[model samples]
Target: MTQARRNGVLSDATFDDVRRDAWPVVLLPFGATEPHNTHLPYGTDTILGSEVAARVAAHCMAAGTNVMALPAVPFGVNTTQLDLPFTINVMPSTQLALLRDVIRSLEPHGVRALVLLNAHGGNELRALVRELQPSTPIMLAIVNWWQAADHATFEQAGDHAGELETAAIMHVAPHLVAPDRHTWGDGRSNPSTLEGVRRGVAWMPRRWTQATVDTGVGDPRAATAENGAAFVAQAVERITAFCCELAVADPSSLWAPAP
Candidate 1:
């Protein structure tokens, strides 16, 4: 059964009782409502993120562990998609507030730590993480599911709607992909790292209009289900490992620096 996939069934008899074999851990799919090229669905990001969360939760549970995967949070900070129609851009503060509220709401109910399975590249969650550290004092952390897979196996590094994402989408939801959009589109046009791929490097945002014109970055044609399977396997393994690690970590210890 899906961890927290709530049906109309009575709440008391569901997850809290039926799935008592494991500890209460939440796997959240934080996604964005934005454009994902012509071929891909607007919910592609969350779809993948939710897929990862579900698979990872299953893996963890099978290993004699307890975990619950919550339904995905589909709306995120999609400022990059602002110009596009139907692109809902929630403010950072709003996102943070929502997260904080969720954390607080979930904490008292035995939901210890959270695995933030995020998908949107536009959402800047690092600052939100910092802000929540002191308030909730839970074992909270972020995990961008798209980046959890091994890049070497991907045959394409991380980028928007590029090789990795395309392959992943193809793997998870092949029927949703538009073949014409995949075949007709030009090669990935955007430089995902306009400011360079270094911390504190010269910063310049790549405007979606000019940089991501086709609404994609990497080569989608290069994608395949095989690559997506590998990515999913690796991501599930990695995400499960992270979930296990975070399960035992103390929130106070987060402040300590490693040498």
Candidate 2:
């Protein structure tokens, strides 16, 4: 079952359903199309972003919240990874424009809330939100799904194609994971830039080629599907609670000087 009408999945929902129901908030899944080391699929970020949004949206719908899951934006800002093969890059300006158009589309439909469930580290939507806030009545939120919670469920929560991602893919789509053919990641860092970044004294995009030959940032040796399942379940629980709150929050009082 697509769970279209039940969950308010935009692509799956019919035009009539969308027109009939007043959705309180729409989830915009932002992801990246890039290399996640040599072992993981290129669509790792997309898969994570879309799946998290879908799952949370489903939960909210089951709880009778007016939440809708928009279609996943599969391309993200991958300027640093442009040299890598087939790493589709969308500049920050393009991202802002894309967000503007999406927001514009939602305005006519009476949807005033948008939650950006971002799965890619390279794609940051905060700046876009700051720029577009004054222009619209929409309440925008940018959530980095991977960092939404402390994933202590895993023994090692590797950043890139490390334990965390590998385990996540295992639980979400085990058929796509090939651990047998996987190369272990070490979370290597460039000596020239690593210290500066660690000290917070300088900032620069780390080239994948310069970071590691495999483009991996963490070790996946300790990753397990069981751990992934726990992590994902926790994330869903946390995000669902937030969504439920957003569903009923008064738009006028969202920012009242934080008294």
List TM-score per model, in order. Answer: 0.84, 0.92
**What is the lDDT, from 0 to 100, of the residue 17 in candidate 1?**
54
lDDT digits (tens) for residues 115-220 of candidate 1: 7888888777889889897777567778888777678875665477777787888899999888765353544674455445335566655567767767777767
TM-score of 2: 0.92
TM-score: which candidate is best? 2
Total clashing residue pairs per candidate?
A: 1, 1
Worst lDDT window (10 residues) for model 1?
4-13
Q: What lDDT tens digits, residue by residue, belong to model 2 across residues 40-125? A: 88899899888888889889888998789998999999898889999999999999999999999988878868999999888878
| Best-performing candidate as measured by lDDT | 2
Those runs of model 1 whose alpha carbons end farther than 4 Å from true positions after fitting are 1-22, 181-184, 190-200, 252-259
